[model samples]
Target: MFKKIKYGKIEVRSQTLVLFSAIYFAFILNLAFWRYILGHVQINNFANFFFIISTAISVVSAFYIFFNLIIVPFAAKPLLSLLLLFSSIVNYMMFSLNVFVDKDMMRNVFETTTAEAWDLVTIPGVIWVLVLGILPAVFLIRIKIKYLSFKKELFSRIKLIAIAIILLLIQVPFFYKSYASFVRNHSEIGHLLNTSNYIDGTIKEIKTRLNSNHKFIRLDENPSLVLNDDGAKTVFILMIGETARDANFSLGGYKRNTNPFLRKEDVIYFKDVKSCGTSTAYSVPCMFSNLTRSGFSQSKARYMENVLDLIKRAGYDVIWQENDEGCKHVCDRVTIENMLERKNSPYCRTGYCLDEVFLEGLDKKLMNIKKDTVIIMHTMGSHGPAYYKRYPDRFKIFKPTCDTSDIQNCSRESVINTYDNTIVYTDYIISSVINTLKKFPNLESGLLYVSDHGESLGEKNLYLHGMPYAIAPEEQKTVPMILWMSDNMKALDYINYSCLKSKAKDNDYSHDVIFHSLLSILEVKTISYNPDLDIFRSCRTRRFPY
Candidate 1:
């Protein structure tokens, strides 16, 4: 009754404890991968929670495996590992998130509503789930095939002590790994908060940040150059947009003549403009901040001066008009954005609003201001899944539309046509703004149009944008930028139109150049202005200054 066992009829004793430990270890590995996917990567607590679940699972599993492995012969699969494998898979599913996955909501999870639209138009978390999922089951099945055996006397009560020790030892590593990951994760969040200030100052030095701190800075005895023209009567509107591709625009030279009305206006179209980012969350913040595309990746956005604050300081009236529903506050410090963004209505939709809504009060708002005013008209141009949602009902130019929110149900061609239709509408919207600006007899009005980021339209079977910037496709990088000057502004010596025209078609332009170009056009000067970095300085070449 002390120690007697047979290993598949081989006379040597079977070390069932080691085999049980290996199977248990494999299951823990499987579950650990799942925990990472569900965005539930707590430290020891998560591991411990799963371990407790595994223990409960093992209770039922022990009985099943014992009968299946010993009493009932030829099961081919290991009982312990099978429980471990299946349980681990279920746990992974529990941790799955929709943020990193594409359309995973069709699975009908308990956690359907997300803080993000289309979980914020980002990739769903299921990509990792599938890759890490099936291997555990396969490995566990193989382990059972290779390790099934019987130990006759060692199944006694006193031997239970050794079995308990074996389970605990194998379980410790998984618990420790989870603990380490959690510690690292929390520290990263802490770092993001800490670095926000340092980054803000550096970006402000270049005049590319939102200028949230500019008010506090202006309070200083020696302040930066201020945007307040002190009643010179100037206005500026910065249209912070989202996920708009250059190809969709009629003004940007799309074959569809999407910007049909824009062509008749006096706008300088920078046909070869490129975007710094592919996603709105990443790009919009970066564009407003002074950080370069290369610098944005290695650092956090918290410490930069967004462009709006600089505009405020240079003495221009600043306003943020937003149509993008999911847009974040990159210009928060400079001016509070007036919500052109629509609330829920029959025509009002989720994730974004129509370009028409943005135009609704623009003319009225323009007359109210006497300062050299600036207005940012944020557009919901071509932000997808429901690309047709960005435009009004009348803009549905393409016949046989796929105007529903469920993107997959619609054909790819239908989805693209609907998206391009929104581009067509965007073309009209920009032209209308140009016309409104022309009404001021004494005003030297100009408009600088830039997209927050570009989008992907069915390239390599990829539906949208935001493939890490390093691998972002051309459709997501090439943006269409145009600067329109009223005849009054150019003819009256407010700007050198011929010089701007020379550089408009150059391929080396980027959002980086906008920081300096805006200041050049507006006539603002700061101590930190680098002639080489500023777009209008004589030292800068015909190409890009940034």
Candidate 2:
């Protein structure tokens, strides 16, 4: 069979292949890990240098032992090749994009759409994978492994494992204190461990999904609307933003005029608001749940009733207009208008539609509003590495933008320019929604615009979001939240706009306030409503008209 093949093959012992693969992963495939280690660990003397060398040896030995145990004669080549390919891609993302592949990021990967996934596929990334991942994997597939007798192979594996363990253990005793201190301070180091990081993350995500019971747990049983004395219908729009950080908003003191349109509106901009999670997979569902950021669980929230459910139960016409990805399953029970599926809309292209697509039939929808309603417009705001694609060319107010998805290749100024342009576009969308709402004076109208999470635009070498919340920089957590209420809505709800504006400026807020705030805004009286978390509680002069 080997002689018949036209392509040449390299014959090697199973043990030899495992050792080489382990060394390759530990050294060549772990550039980000080694870079992080070197940058964080200071070498003051010969002893420190020796400790670094010992750490490398220990990592290499550990990989060798793991590979030796897992790689059988029949499965060695395929398994190792797959690992090499995946590790190379992971390494490129970590080293170039500065993204950490933890459980939440893995969840993002699984939940990401094909179009969103393609946005990440850049020329540089393809080249990196071809050179480092594909070439090695192909070479590995062509290699034939020679196995010894069963008893001999078993003894050989045991001997190698013992030697690797000894090498790893010897360093621990000499540098135990150094290791402890390094781990204690830099807990994020584990997220850089090339293959293990993503693999462990994937496993943990899978386990969480499997363990979830998927039962719908209703929160409020007899929730009812606190009807106002005035017979006017209320229309509230909750605009959920994507990848929009407060740092770029002019309303939030950003140098650029990203919120050019929003600044002109009567919107109250909350500058110091944080998100429940750093990624959409976690934050979107979390913000609507009664659970606060610290107490949120994705599995539990998935099956439980959220704010939308409660509001719908309270007799409001709830509709979710999705322009981004599928609402992270939060709109599963609600009436969803998937704007991306709309036929031949001018704002839509092949893969995705711009935020303006939400305005297409919105006027007609607003005109037909008869009852109190809550509409969620989930906008594709500043979602990148294709920030340039999020907005139209006319909205490209910031010039010399980073046009390509390979954002790392662009200058930092170009990246920010491109990102700010998206914010500018978002400002247009939000203002358009508010303007549309303003036209309908008969209906008590208002809008709440809050980002699901923020983005990292080359801050601290971090290109995008999804860093663990514990160590995530403010760039990924701090988001802009804008609230707009028409005069009629304010009068009907007895909400003091001045008081709310004061609260927006002085108080610290997070995604935790969203559920209660929505309940308070709509006057949905239920046992699940917590007055303490409501930002509008103090501002509302009158009590609920139950």
Q: Considering every candidate listed, which one attains the maximal lDDT?
A: 2
Best by TM-score, which number?
2
Instruction: Specify the poorest-scoring 10-residue window by lDDT in model 2.
Output: 1-10
State how far residue 57 of model 1 sits from its true place (Å): 23
Candidate 1 residue lDDT tens string, 102-200: 111111122223422363232232333233435644543433232323454335422644454555556645566654665465332211111121233
What value does the lDDT take at residue 222 in candidate 1? Answer: 23
TM-score per model over all chains: 0.60, 0.97
Model 1, residue 541: distance off in Å is: 15
Off by over 4 Å in 1: 1-232, 297-299, 340-352, 491-494, 537-546
| Residue 414 local lDDT, model 1 | 84
Predicted candidate 2 versus true structure: per-residue lDDT over 94-183, tens digit per residue: 999988889998999999999899999998899999999999888777777777899999999999999999988877789988888888
Model 2 spans with C-alpha error above 4 angstroms: 1-8
TM-score of 1: 0.60
Please state the error at residue 284 of candidate 1 in Å.
Answer: 1.3
Error of 1 at 477 (Å): 0.9
